[model samples]
Target chain A: MLRSGPSVILFLAWRGLRQYGLSSIVAAFSIALAGGLFLSTWKIKTETEKAFRVYDGGFDAVLGVRGSKVDLVLNSIFHVSNGPDKPLTQEQYENLKNNRAVKEAIPLSGGDNYKGFRMVGTIRKLFEDHEWRPGRKYELAAGELFADDRQEAVFGAFVARKLKIRVGDVIQPYHGLDFTGEDSVHPNDFVVTGVLEPTGTPADHVVWIPIEGALNMPGHAEGLGFAPSSVLIKFQPKAKREYLQLLYYYRNHPELMMPDILMTIAPLFEKFKAFEFALTAIAALVALTAAGVILATLRSAMNEKRREIAILRSLGARRATVTASILAHAGLITLLGIIGAFAIFAGIGSFAADYIREEVGVIIELFEYDPIFLQVSAGMLAIGLLSGLLPAIQAYRSDVAQNLTPTS
Target chain B: MAFLEIANLRKSFPSPEGGELPVVEVKEFTMQAGDQLALRGTSGSGKTTFLHLIAGILKPDAGAIHIDGECISEFHEARRDLMRANSIGYVFQSFNLLQGYTCLENLLLPMAFAGEANQERAEELLEQVGLDHRMGHYPRQLSIGQQQRVAVARALVNEPKLVLADEPTGNLDPSSAAQALELLRKLCVDTKAALLLVSHDQALVDSFDQNLDWRDLNAAFEQATGTS
Candidate 1:
């Protein structure tokens, strides 16, 4: 018995596709276009969001040196591009840590990039703060984390993915601020201890070493004196008002160069939320338009297959059977197209990480495809299926008898 | 009771200008199992319409058709579909063979749709039509007679109790027409299914067991058997 098993149905659906080979290819292309755009934007957005959200690793506030809040915000939070413009000495960090309003403070030292990425020199408290997502904890694929403190280093996922460095691999570091001189590009060789699992964020593209490691380096990076970019301060939720007053008052202290400079713009989170809103809105509009194109293409294809459907009906195919066949065909085409598009993007993700960072400021790791890829792909598929529903229903509802009668 | 029976069958359509237009007004008709019957008519004579009505493809404005003791005309659209799948097969005049399918694919179509892939039965039926060697070829590659032979093979794939064909060989050459008729004759006996062929070809009509004219079929409802 030639029963239509899943494989048989797959074969039949595949065979049915050959009748309108060109149309089927077009359908796939449309689906790929829709799925690809959604995925590329979705992946980049998700990873970038994940990167920015990394700021929430528990430090609600940062009590920097007497001045240069922006520099403090840049370096201590993002671990890059923030100059230690003001030497926020160790006493201030200690003072904030011991304050009634302060919960915890993690210090960061951003020195140099072995390549285009920053080398974050921080403590274990970094991972402890955020309550890292699954598998975010460091695992030793070969050697241990930077236990020795002075020169030992830890690697991020991208170190291996991009630089092809392995545990025990020694790479030269460069001076952070004085990036001009050739000497700045190659500071000293440090052995790669452990490789961090991909966070799908900026961290994935960075290397980690003890703050002392950068502090011991040459002129700019290894701070000659007190090289604190900023002091991260976490305040208890209820401590905001009084602490804000204290922060304002402290800023006014003559020691802070200009203590009167207490600026209140928007909450960092508000800025992020608004940015999120705008990016997602653009993505949604583009996705909707892609969906419309999909609908038009599918509806037109169904019209072309009307006669074939009629023939199937006259051959005793039930309406549901006919409908299923059409749906299956549409779905298969959309699926193939989506996969192709995804493959293209996956290629981009792997091969163009540095280029993307250079071009768009998206510091995503090329090691792992973002996990959100599946969610985005599923959404694309749903959109495609919904797009096809109108034609499928039309094919379903039409009278079999009328369609079966061949017109002269 | 006849193997198939229709009573008080009336079909009407809304005229393009507005009111109702009466199409076919047959009050009664009956055929025994295994009967080869021809429904003859001119263009728009309602021969195809009557065939569709009996095959459960169309609902009469008012009437009933019983096939193998099942009153199909009264069945809902869904049941009619099931009835068509399980008990009836149609051989469209245009050879309505799916162009997407090969010759064997066409022959196997009914069995495939009927959810019974019975390869042995399909092969035997194909042999019955004497075209077993042409299974792999698509319908387009086959001659008109060969394609018609395939249509007949499909009609018997499910061993249906009733086979409805519209102009079964209208496009075929004389030889193909005679051959298709011969296949249809053997199909009725082998499957125990009554065959209803609708066509304008009088020669094909004379070849069947019973012949009925479209104008004569609408005689007084009570005069059906008498006219027969």
Candidate 2:
């Protein structure tokens, strides 16, 4: 019982849409596909940048052997690669730990893996002092952490769940980053002492063992000597001058390299700029094609419904009423497309977030409200209305008498 | 004053060759309230064009068309459209019901345009036209006679002062045509609305109390054909 006004126009438009069911569905689906891809690509790019840029792993800088600063940070901080080419000796680690400007220094060593999960050896001070974020220290989910002198290990949450290891379970380290040969397995068995709670960082995929366990292993004492892979350092809160001095000092040092962690990670995204741009271009092209589909479908519908429109006019519908009805039809299709787009975006965003967390160890906020969603929706709505314009004009100019006449 | 009046009403379309081709030119015509008048004419003789002018579907190039003392010809196209929606109902020869809408919805459509859509009134009219059982059926689902009945119900849904029916039964068989005409005229009387019917069937026109041939009524047709 809609009165003659916008509501009536909307009612008639909805009826017209339902009358052209398959074409309407195809148009809406195309729009949804475009919108979903646009949103997913944008979200992945922005969220990945945010995650990497704001990464805080409880230390200000990484000091390693003279090598690629990116490789040093990626290996030492993110635990995603083989360790740096050369290791800093225990004497250098002790020197940095005892420096007047250094508040704390944690040594990290990695050479072996268990079931494809990298095992890192670090000091007890790391567990006791480091806060991954301000006021958020890691807590053990099961038993006690490994002692600095013992041949024991702690498992990260993801590794523990994946390998199904428990406290007191014994694991043997493999000689390489991946499972290579039966003879590559170390003879010593490290008892699982604890499992750390989920930290949503690279640490979630690591196995933590004491530095003594890594240094004293069978073949390691003869070939590697007493050297740690890298030393992660934090300067005193009021020692900004000394921190910059040390960074400058390491720039030309013959055997050492120190880099600001944030500076080192920011450039990684630069490598992805071309890939991101390609995805964005493809999304935009699909969106434009979707707009064309809407235009073609609506125009075809108007052609098929010309006689019906004339009959409506003969029943006293004003030209504006019929025209508005066509616009309303387009609006409804766009609305459906936007809703479907959100569903598709959610599905894809969740998958991307999970993949990044598992493979790259970065947590992406998938459902945060980004203005791009609103902006894209508005743009699509405007395009939809524009697509309906020609058909609306055709309806406005329809000849009531001629179209309403009997064909016979 | 007459319920419907037209004075020197003229309308023309652009001719394919050149110049304007006069379609309808009625010197004067009037119908009183509650009256039934039939207009008879041959094919392409300006009968439908004259009806279109009266219904305000087409603007008169020069003249005045007044319905119930209001001059619609002088009004703008939008205002004329509003006047038509609120004061006049139309039925076409082919039972031009919206194929998407049910019989009941078709009856309610005119009322919606009139800004006074009443579901109860639409149902009552459908019942009156013997379409109560077919109210939920779409036009394509209904028979020819049923569709015509739905058209008749729609015409009176707004209780307009004038109902213009253009060959409302032309597509029906002889028996269905006579029945449709009787039902339409009966409903017009029941609603107290004036009826102006245009048809080529002389037998149908003979049933009306008053009837006029289009050749005599439209001076433009007589001039164009060079006929009396």
Candidate 3:
């Protein structure tokens, strides 16, 4: 008995591709594109999910005068979307701040823009509550956050990327409720006093200035009695449920002048979670479609390889061996395509992260492993394997004897 | 006892045009070790089908097939594959040498398929086929004759007891054909393998130890059926 080597038909399997001509190349490409579609969609959805999870850690109610739900949600926290220019007054900010049951309240003011990006005005101490630290907080890759409400500003990561901003460069902000367009004029010249380390969030796209400086800006005029888009509050440990009830009572009191159009942000966050799940499902479908596309290509190629398949059987190759050969070949191509797609996704992640933060104030770090990624990838792979099975079996079940005959 | 025996073999297919079309039928055929027999026929006269059935690539509708005197007709696929691998060596007219592999790789193919990779034996077969210098050349790089020689080497590499070749030299030039046939015959005699050569070339068939005309075999099949 002559001892054989690895029973692998990898060599013959490879020949099967070459024997068929240009068909295999088409299959490889189709499989690759399908895998890439699954990969990129998964990456984007995963990034969005990750960014939302980060947002989840902070904030509760969005207390504002009036606006659309999506717009209010965006500006209340994001500040880039549309909202009232005249947010809550100092008295209103202080009113929430003084409420003993409130525990802690962070006030946000809207005023200026650095180029086409916003300069958010907020209380300084709240940065600490946001867990913004010396090592982690607005560390100036170049300078420091403005210490006073003067002509000074902290540049967002994206703005810095675009403007090539550096310490001591004066930046003039446009006067508008929305910074969608640039209208830089009127001594809005703010020295680039700081550059924040990338937070991979919308904050990375902002220009932070003192609330006093924002109020002094000409754009800050003609707007009054408007509560800030939102006030984030943290309850004391073991705080009672009555505290929220009393706060709501005060919010509606006629004398309080609180707007009836208050949107509690907790529900908004729950809505976001639901939205994330829907999107994840959508991502899974897209990935499966990619796999389905690959299977269809393989099925098409089966007809073209009939002669070669017949030849394999004539050589005493069992039906299963031929089937195994097809499966092994296509399976390998899919796996390789998956790896290639992953590399492609990794390469584009940073740019994508920047895009999210700038277009919407959501920071998305590249290396963060969102579980949705694995879920989507697994689903896609399962589809791919399932797709390969039928073709492989067909290859196995084919009549090898008839195939070998030249006349057939 | 003969190396291969076929008794009342019948096989057919469900033709697209209609009911079962009888492809090949043979009654009481036997070949001993060291005998070279040639089967001559037209394209559709069941020549390839005969080789296929003997090689266990196809199952007969009804027949008895024996390799080394043991009935293999009723054996399952796994058992038939083992018998085919151990006893039967086959060469196709196309040389079917996997284009991607080198000559040595082609020669080693059967051994690899049968899980009987004997590197030394494979090298020796390459040397015997006069392809020692071209072992590293791919089948595509070799001429048709050289490729056939490599195929022959592959067929005989596993040292099977019976060698079956379907038009072993059909695609080769005259001189190469002579060389390939002489090699097949010599290898059969030397290794004690029952060599069954199928071809349309009457001249080549006449030179074999015995000749089985497909016309006579078909007549025999019909007579046996008519008698039964």
Task: Enumerate residue pairs that collide in model 1.
Answer: A173-A187, A251-A259
Q: Write the per-residue lDDT of candidate 3 for residues B127-208, one digit (tens) a residue.
A: 9989899988988888888888888888887778888888888889999999998987877677778888888898999987
For residues A66-101, could you state the per-residue lDDT of candidate 3 as single tens digits?
445455556656665676634666686676667666
Report the C-alpha lDDT of model 1 over B1-228, residue by residue, as the tens digit: 999988888876666778866666887899888888887766566677777788777788898888878888889876787678678888878878877777777766567666657777777777778778877878888888888888888877887888888888888888878878887877678778888877777777877668977667854222222222
Model 2 lDDT tens row, B135-213: 8999999889889989988988999889999899999999998899999999999999999998889989888979998
Candidate 2 lDDT, A1-408, residue by residue in tens = 578998789889899789888888888888898899989999989998999888858888899988788888888888876678877887888878887679989898889888888989998888888888889888999999999899999999999998999999999999877767777899999999999999999898999999878888886746656689998888898887876777678887898988889998998999999998999899888888888988999999988888999889888889999999999999988888899888999999999999999887889997888899899899888888888888999998888878888521
Report fnat for all candidates as fractions from 0 to 1.
Answer: 0.46, 0.59, 0.33
Q: Give candidate 3's root-mean-square deviation (CA, Å).
A: 5.2
What TM-score, over all chains together, does every model reach? 0.73, 0.97, 0.79
lDDT of each: 0.68, 0.87, 0.67
Candidate that would win on TM-score:
2
Candidate 2: regions farther than 4 A off: A180-184, A221-225, A406-408, B224-228
DockQ of every candidate structure: 0.40, 0.63, 0.37
True contacts kept of 1: 0.46
Model 1 chain A: which ten-residue window has the lowest total lDDT? A257-266
The candidate that wins on DockQ is: 2
